[model samples]
Target chain A: MVGGGQLARMTHEAGIPLGIRFKLLSDTPQDSAAQVVNDVVVGDYRDLDTLREFARGCDVITFDHEHVPTEHLRALEADGIPVRPGPDALVHAHDKGVMRARLDAIGVPCPRHRIVSDPADAVAFAAEAGGFPVILKTVRGGYDGKGVWVVRSEDEAAEPFRAGVPVLAEEKVDFVRELAANVVRSPSGQAVSYPVVESQQVNGVCDTVIAPAPNLPEELAGQAQELALRIAEELGVVGHLAVELFETADGRILVNELAMRPHNSGHWTQDGAMTSQFANHVRAVLDLPLGDPRPRVKWTVMANVLGGDYPDMYQGYLHCMARDPQLKIHMYGKDVKPGRKVGHVNTYGDDLDDVRERARHAADYLRGTITE
Target chain B: MVGGGQLARMTHEAGIPLGIRFKLLSDTPQDSAAQVVNDVVVGDYRDLDTLREFARGCDVITFDHEHVPTEHLRALEADGIPVRPGPDALVHAHDKGVMRARLDAIGVPCPRHRIVSDPADAVAFAAEAGGFPVILKTVRGGYDGKGVWVVRSEDEAAEPFRAGVPVLAEEKVDFVRELAANVVRSPSGQAVSYPVVESQQVNGVCDTVIAPAPNLPEELAGQAQELALRIAEELGVVGHLAVELFETADGRILVNELAMRPHNSGHWTQDGAMTSQFANHVRAVLDLPLGDPRPRVKWTVMANVLGGDYPDMYQGYLHCMARDPQLKIHMYGKDVKPGRKVGHVNTYGDDLDDVRERARHAADYLRGTITE
Candidate 1:
């Protein structure tokens, strides 16, 4: 795996029981996955030579993030190392412009979007998209709400174009809620989709996810899954593909974005799904048969534990475990940095409200957002 | 962790999500836990200086096995490296004679037995118990039916003493089936117990385990749990204690043996129980609050995959996973050897027969004991 973030850390954990030997290419020894995985090469994923050195003797190459240059990945593939979700597929996740164009060409439902040449072009696209209030995003290298702006005027749109990368102007849909449909596919074409989940975000960063998307029409849930599976097939994705969607106020779903690796929206599956996304990603990258993706309970809620006033989340375990013995708390082994995603807490039971409260309480307590 | 094996491997995996850093003491790099844990000191655990070196920067010392010398544990404690299930408690698990005496004094029901000085003394005790057939065992270091014998004659009785260990003689009680009650306790005295499980052994090696021990009388199950908890307290054990019991033909349960760490009988908890034995064991060792130990389903069946003609179990995943998507397979990273436990499979649902069959089929298929 390239990149030693929490996703790689979790994927490595899932691989342990399967007897998989993990070799990681990380930026530093202190990286989340590097602290746990035995064989770690401290290097740059951006450098082609570093990537080639990392791929030697590895059965396949996968990622914790999609920041690796598309050309670097193609070179690795040419060197005979199997790069899952190969360069062609990964580009759809790495670049917003490419993703919007591909989804549109495939007749997939998506917000009105276009690659803008400059701030003037962005304003023109916004005008074409029905005037003000547009979402402007850098075509490449944006995550966790960074490099993204909600532009209400031409002056506000110039910031994105100034990043010196192609800017994508998209209509900001008035959606009732955000939902994610996570699917995993193998090289042999075996695929499995998890239940569509309702994702709640604060400041464009995910805060909580409710599995099965509460109050959703059953048919709509099935449609979201079919859409994700179709996307995976059309894109030739050979690992986890998280399709972020917008459930409009008018009762319609539109593609919001795509993530070709494990995403925050699927973290709830760690405790709730029969097979976690991390496990399925490992299986997919290895070209092994995928495991079941059914929810294990009636409801499961996951709330992100963002770093806050508390520097160490370990102190929260005492009260949290004592209060909710059934709660599953997963920490990223990263030092606490305020507002950073340090971990997540999962709660599940028959009652959705109770599960949600339990998850939220634990997450809040860990984040020091609540004391009691 | 002081030993490198599947137990250690699973424990390390459990600690991963908790962001717990693990340093292992192993005999070789190829050991199961050593392959995954980043910091592993290759040295003999029996050597006091090597152990002292390993314990230098550790938070606490724990084990994957009980072979670590009791005195060495005491020395580590003297060095201020807290050894969970401290030396005093570990001695009970290390030596059967001490365990029997302790249990008898505590009024815990166990088989009638005593230490025999010689073959004549064994025969005398056999005659005293109105039986020629009796069980003879080495007072210490017996596991998986090793160092134990069912002796029907004086010649057979003499074999155990020749090994130069004190022999413990006991009446061979005819039992209906084997069961195990697992419990975990923290140093602060917090304790949790998993549902008692029915264990099936072939050739004295665990073959299958059914969680909640189907058909067990409710009160009797509670009594077994209470007994196990009482034992953990009595011995001052600070980690997992698996009390092996015999459900006799007369409808009474008797203590058979005890293990101080994660045992085979509790393996079902990995997929069945809300808090796995491995996770709980880690929590207990770290002196953290214990998590819930409740069954997540109606029943879960676990079947061991012993090494047979199949050398690599990887080939079995496609067939097993395709046939039963819900099957949870956990494989130890070990080279296959005849009759060696290489992995296990867990299947769970509302149907007992279906669950058991699925687990058994996957395990057998993995072992190459069955095809199609």
Candidate 2:
């Protein structure tokens, strides 16, 4: 239990009844989960002494963030403290360049990409791979809609290199939809996969996720789940592993990225699945038996609330709640900021379109885009 | 949400999303729910000025306990604060004598009893009712096996008169099982009922609750649900209402007691039912549309953990958890105490007996009574 964000908060919430104690390493005084769990030590995750002290009495160490220093985790492992999704596997989530190389070596299908240390390399890759509208991403530490760039031309791609950050130039993928398939794996190599979800991104930030990826062929869903499970088993990752996939115009799925902890797309499991991703993550990290990963409902949709400039953004919830009381919303106890991941709402029902629309309406209402 | 006990704490857990905030009123710094919900004001619920301060900016005022003063609630009502299950209805729960009289007047099937102001009346009632064994209860306040006594002989029946506490006496009927039916009602008079559950009580404290009350005839379950709904409507309770019933040897259902808040018997709804009792309580208190009260599984069982003097109580959970990983346990984050309503474990499955056994084992392990 480190980092007191919504993910840590939700994980702590799920762990309480299991009689599993988690000592959260909170970054702020008002971390959402800390309000209920008192064993929080306020500190920075980057501080080695703080990390060491937090891990002292714990039997194992895990994380809420992928930004943990790999060398520090390796050091903790050397001191006999078990770190799940060990340092060897975490680097894939921390560094984009390392991930691309590893996935490419493993023959995982991905868009054409090239590591560009200099502006000239990006220019050359663009000319050979594709022209303009290339995707540029930081080699290390990027999340939500940050640390990624959409370069319309070669000149735009060259500007980031001047700032001394490693970047990758990816071919503009002609994808029909963004999909995410998540799998949880135990240290013993057992794994379970959830249904693939269609992820709708607004301004590079995920806004909505529909499980079973509406209209996706059953074969494709099977293929996507298999791909995610293969990656989890191959990486020997202990914890939830999310594989973001791109459904190309040709209906082929390509790897987009990976997350080792519980991902946003799987939040629907809180109300829709037999076992939630957060609960499974805890089980995986603790080396316990995995739970059934089947969806409990026919369809589930999750919509995220991108924080906007509204003081009483939640006040609008009264109307949404009054209109459709079945909608489930999870708000992180974090201050609102433009384009930040504030909270999410999930709805599960027999009608996918209706669930999706209702979820989106609540998100749009929360973001202050609706009059009623 | 003034009190930081298990009910308030569980409600806070459900209120995380949709951002419903709770201002916990605690008498001690370590009140369990207070530890997680940061917005707590330390005060007694008896103080009107303190309650006014607590209710200043709240949209709706609700409760976890029915012990708040009726006069203070009436004052708040006159001042225009929206208190769900207003003083009039809540008073019925706080005073057992009033509840009994009201139910008797309504023609609801209940045990023939008399409100005894002292032990002499109880002795007299026992003589009239033709019983050596009689049950005596406090009229104004009692809960969880407290404020009630069994007078097996004439001398014992007359002993409580010296204490000057008002008592209620009832014939000790031979009953097969205790059952509880939970119903939720909104301000608009719409009400919903959950499946009746057979409660297992040890020493007057409820230890386990088996949902659908195994082998209950279809007509009996329907009759219980209808009786509970009728009670809720007649009482005009604008939130959760729990009717405790005794299934006499002849199969007749007799009302035993009532609760105005989310009752412990309904905890199974959190995981087993389509709409959780907590979520429904929120909807009812907020005057929102009620959700569908359908059970997802055929059976669900909840077992309470009585914090006994067991060394390394949590250590026992490891073994129980290892055996049944999916059993859901909700802990109250309280210090250990004998006969205390510390927490509960719930398990739901199609196989009723298996779920019951699993729940029973987890609770027994916590109570230091589980055999290998």
> What is the clash count for each candidate, in the order shown?
0, 3
lDDT of 1: 0.93
Candidate DockQ values, in order, are: 0.83, 0.39
**DockQ for candidate 2:** 0.39
Per-candidate local distance difference test: 0.93, 0.83
lDDT of 2 by residue, B93-150 (tens): 9888889889988999988798876656777888888865888887766788787778
**CA displacement after TM-score superposition, residue B179 of candidate 1 (Å):** 0.7
Q: Which residues of candidate 1, in runs, are more than 4 Å off?
A: none
Task: Indicate the worst ten consecutive residues by lDDT in candidate 2 chain A.
Answer: A13-22
Compose the digit string of candidate 1's lDDT tens values, residues A30-97.
99999998899999999999999999999999999999999999999999999998999999999998
Worst 10 residues of 1 chain B by lDDT: B124-133
